[model samples]
Target: MHAIEKQKSPMQSLAESVLDAHTANFWLQKINPLWSVSQPLGKIIEIQSAATDTVSLKIKVNRHFLMGKAGQHHPVIVEIAGRRYERTYSLTQLDQYHVLLTVKRIAQGVVSQWLCNTAKVGDVLHFGQPYGDMTVTPEQQPALILLAAGSGITPMYSLLKALDYSNKISTQTITLMYWVKQHADAAFANYFESLAQQHANFKVHIFHTQEAPCDARLNKNHIDFIKDLSNSTVYACGPSGFVNTAEQLFTSAKNFKSEAFSLTPIISDEGGFINVTLTKSNKTIAIPKGQSILVGLEQQNIQPQHGCRMGICNKCSCNKVQGATKNLVNGVENTEPRNSLRICVNSAQTDLIIDI
Candidate 1:
């Protein structure tokens, strides 16, 4: 009788489990029902030269169904030498049913190196879902001040394409200040030159770090150029230092906006192991190689807050009570000298004492 009851109880529990999903995990799935999604590393169709070192990547998404917002960014996942890596890139255009991405392959970059060297037209890519807060609304009716450095010109390109090519928005003019190392480093020079040639409103200012024949240097003089310009709504994107410097430069009375694509540093043990202490539960856990602090905690079913999981939204920002982590993009070490860590990007190094 006991044996029979055990089997019957297991079956009963399975039946009850199905019914419980509606009540407990209803919000686990997508908010929109019709939005089918997949993350395939797309095929590289064309890679265009904008200026010098700046290159625009045009990729075709693997899709017979489902679509995405024009200016959203998607994660690019690649496997190299049996190691998996993921990085985010913004969509440049909706060239037919396939997707498009523009990327500048920095010499110090990992994924960028792969794309510049090995990525070809027929090669497949594993892509994450489109995400970003930088979409343009046609009804917003605000003059755009586009600030970009090097390859950060991508999002602005998407907005420009949407606003100009699609004729979706009514605008006065778009003032674009695209800073690069030299004229050759500007990725969309020809395209923007065409816009400047054709439109009375679209204007571009190129600031070169290196002495170039046809541009302005992005020094105090470059910042001074905007002093007389109208306070059109500002939108800036670039490297961490570049973005911060631009923000400080435009920090007068005029309102300037900016977004950063910088990643926090993550640390790990020299021995490829780490000790993670969840100060909340008063428990210490050991994390081995190839695991992030977030994954380490979540393996025990600890669900932490996350927005954009790609280090952008900063929902997972937490104060680190102790220890260290390395930056994934740039191999820089950061110490938790006092408080908070974005656990999503931070990995455990040595014995970490974290207050969740």
Candidate 2:
């Protein structure tokens, strides 16, 4: 006897007849908001204030959503006023079917403002697959140091929760040094303090940089308390300047990993202007050689697709038809044609043509 095959329903059969997934999804979504052939979707289940300008959103993910490792980031897409906008944010997994997304509202930031003020429970959100190499593992070093400044604390918090969930927090000596402008700006302060109270090997320190007697910014003095530099693994996340300082101070440690959420464009001394031609737009613009191509294009009112804006996510990457560009992050110069170019971190070093 032949094995029996399950029969498809009329809706399912009709959906399969659609020419494209998008067309099928357009109808499928009308039946069920989370129903989709490929796109991952989440429903906001809860919202709470994380800090003065920050909010923590608990999202219940659908079956298509792929869970990410601790310390990874997800590109969150939201639709506002008939326009779609995307931004990346660090996520903390709450359970098998849910995740926590904490967002700090940025001044003049469209998505941030909408998420912070307008979004409510039961609102649906779109998510890109999680990406980022920095992740927490079980076989980490005995001593761990976490350095975070401002919104960078999100990833560090996720890593810590992972360690705690895996029962590794009790065995390893972990120290978190977090910097914020004021006490009200610190997110998850009470949670960290409670966790430290329960674990003998864990310590949490919050530094208020703008208080009356301001705590000094990340410096060599901050690591003076750690006795085992050679056996310690250090992780730092923040603005470029803060991460750079952490790298300078902790390079001697056993392992040092850092990620900068924001980068200040590395202005080159080789001053001049270069012409960049947009192949698809049929427009030519003069851009400064020292500044990033993304910044230059934005100055000329050419808004390109971008996420993170720190060169980590490749959302801003485009095809360089022909150009001599220098990477601001690593200072590497590429003169090749028909190559992938990340405009957020690369500056035009000569007259160029790009597919934008």
lDDT of each: 0.62, 0.87
* Clashing residue pairs in candidate 2 (N, C-alpha, C atoms within 3 angstroms): none
lDDT of 1 at 171: 46
Per TM-score, the best of the predicted structures is: 2
Candidate 2: segments with Cα more than 4 A from true spot = 1-14, 17-20, 267-273, 277-283, 288-290, 303-305, 318-340, 348-356
User: lDDT tens digits, residues 1-356, model 1?
Assistant: 00111132343345445646443223322332211122233566776555455455666654422244655676677777778677777776565545566667778777778877667655556666567766665444356678887677888888787777665433455778888776567776777888888776677887777764646534456655453445556677776556656666665524565555654333334456677777777888777644467767778788776644445656678778778775443344678467667776556555788776
Estimated TM-score for each candidate: 0.65, 0.87
Q: Give candidate 1's root-mean-square deviation (CA, Å).
A: 11.6
| Cα error of candidate 2 at position 137, Å | 2.8
Which runs of model 1 end up more than 4 angstroms from their true locations? 1-41, 47-54, 64-70, 139-141, 168-170, 212-231, 252-255, 263-310, 313-352
